[model samples]
Target: MVQSDSKLHEVALQKLNDRGVELKEIAELVYDLQSPYLAELTMQPCLESVKAVIRKREVQNAILTGIELDVLTEEGKLSSPLQEIIEEDESLYGIDEILALSIVNVYGSIGFTNYGFLDKTKPKLIKRLDDHTHSNKTHTFLDDIVGAIAAAAASRLAHDNPGISKIMK
Candidate 1:
């Protein structure tokens, strides 16, 4: 069954992959964040939840826009001052988090809390994406975008599965 929108999301996910972000990695991260709470958690369910979250057009759009900005920064294509800000990933520049909030808003409150944690902790690939000093490639917005995806996926899993609710009891 081929839905018209499926292609759009596939394209978006491909763009993320092209930029070195893997859905499986985000899925695993989601699994890690959520599994401790949802005792019955497994990779397959986590992957499904992650895919479901990505299926949203809004999520797809955010992913594409953020990754595109990162790529442009990497290529040094953006105009002077903007390029410098993006490359440096200045503290005052928060549009990255704002764009990412679009993804977080989809899954409700859990998304916000999870995003906050992941954004602060910068776990694994998230850390790698934010480390711009050593690598020529700049992540700037990519780190927040990646954290948003993982947070949303975790939120989705927590929402869709009743097991998590039970565990909360």
Candidate 2:
């Protein structure tokens, strides 16, 4: 039997693939964008950083936070003031993106650019996740966020090692 962690990885990969993002593409993008500063760290080290973000429960927390907000909104449990606050997806509450930023920070400025592009593009699963906000489901946002984090983390892995791209291809 696959370990729970490995199973999670597999699920994450499936979610990412479903949205049209491939591990190879992500890896190629990372490899192509490497700079002198980032190059010094080596791909494995960078990958470790990305993995750490996932392993450390940071990604899990982001998912939970987003989902909880959705739950509050759906249940009509949020007071007017609180509802107004979360509705904005406010600049101050950028902790989700910030947590994501940690993964990219491993590669310096390039990672930031990559994250921005991914976040804005909402390519594949990301787009589906944003759409899921309208649906009634448990952990809707959280499930998608977990998938997104996995994709981002996987992409970081590919970026660190070009060889991984070849295998995926």
Candidate 3:
């Protein structure tokens, strides 16, 4: 592989691994989703599509959105009624998921489906990393925020690399 491709792969693997998603599991999921006939439809050549969405600027936006609410909680900035609801990660506060979906939407519907699956599955590593974030007494919102990014990255990989699915089988 070209050096840049290798680097991108490494960065992607590290991000997912750190967030608690196993490479093998991700590969298996990709394998399960693959169809030989659909190979031609892959977004592989656009490998950077997902990464572009998860770029630092985009992630920063998510962080700011989440942390702003968190800060409001800390400073008693929000009114009691609003505070209670915001603190609960309410259904209406689905901006996070929406932002996350933006990253996966690049590759098409398949990417969206993969992201949903991974997010719901909450595989062991993801849970552990999230727990660690909460216990660290730091920016707790980043736990889900980062997990979403990692999951999106994994989905990007699955969508871009047909080779990954072949390896899984």
Candidate 4:
């Protein structure tokens, strides 16, 4: 049976795909985060966790909202102050982080720490996304959103595995 929100989920997935973010990329971030804790870890569970996090309605909404803003910024569609703040990804303009926190909040406390670590480390694909010099596209929101996804996915994996879940706590 299809959930009524399946369309939203598909769009969320598509938006990330359109932005050139593959599930495998986020899964790699997940694998990196959980590996030290889980020596026997495999990419399959990390990929599964990323998929499950993206499947959430909350995550879908954040993906849609953030991507829309980035697209608008790229097209120069937003107004002066707001556009500049997002385009430059100003340090003081923390609204992007706040939006990201919403996604992290879904998985409870563990996600917050995980998100912090990823945000600071900018591991793997996230580093590429956040690199302003590499691309003209402004990932102002996408960077944080992508980080949140990886963090939340890692948190989900930790929660699912009782042994590491405690270590996470």
Best-fitting candidate, scored by TM-score: 4
Q: How many angstroms is residue 144 displaced in model 3 relative to the true structure, after the best TM-score fit?
A: 3.8
- TM-score, every prediction: 0.90, 0.48, 0.51, 0.93
Runs of candidate 4 exceeding 4 Å displacement: 1-3, 164-169
lDDT of 3 by residue, 52-166 (tens): 5444454545645655555566566789777665555565766557766655554466666656765676554345533433543222344455445545554555555656454
The residue-by-residue lDDT of candidate 2 on 1-169, one tens digit each, is 6336656555555544544445444443333334332434345544454455455444534544555666676676789866655454544655556545654454456455556766666555455545646644333344335434444554555455565343444
Provide the overall lDDT of each model, using Cα atoms, as 2-decimal numbers: 0.85, 0.50, 0.50, 0.91
Candidate 2 global TM-score: 0.48
lDDT of 1 by residue, 111-148 (tens): 99999999888898898888877788778878898899
Task: Compose the digit string of candidate 4's lDDT tens values, residues 1-169.
Answer: 5436889999899999999999999999999888878767899999999999998998999999999999999999999999999999898999999999999998889899999999998888888998999798989999999999999999888778866543555
lDDT winner, 1 or 2: 1
Among all candidates shown, the one with the greatest lDDT = 4
| Off by more than 4 A, model 3 | 1-53, 91-93, 125-143, 167-169
| Model 4 steric clash pairs | none
Residue 100 accuracy (lDDT) in model 4: 98
How big is the positional error of residue 58 in model 1, measured in Å on the Cα after superposition?
0.6
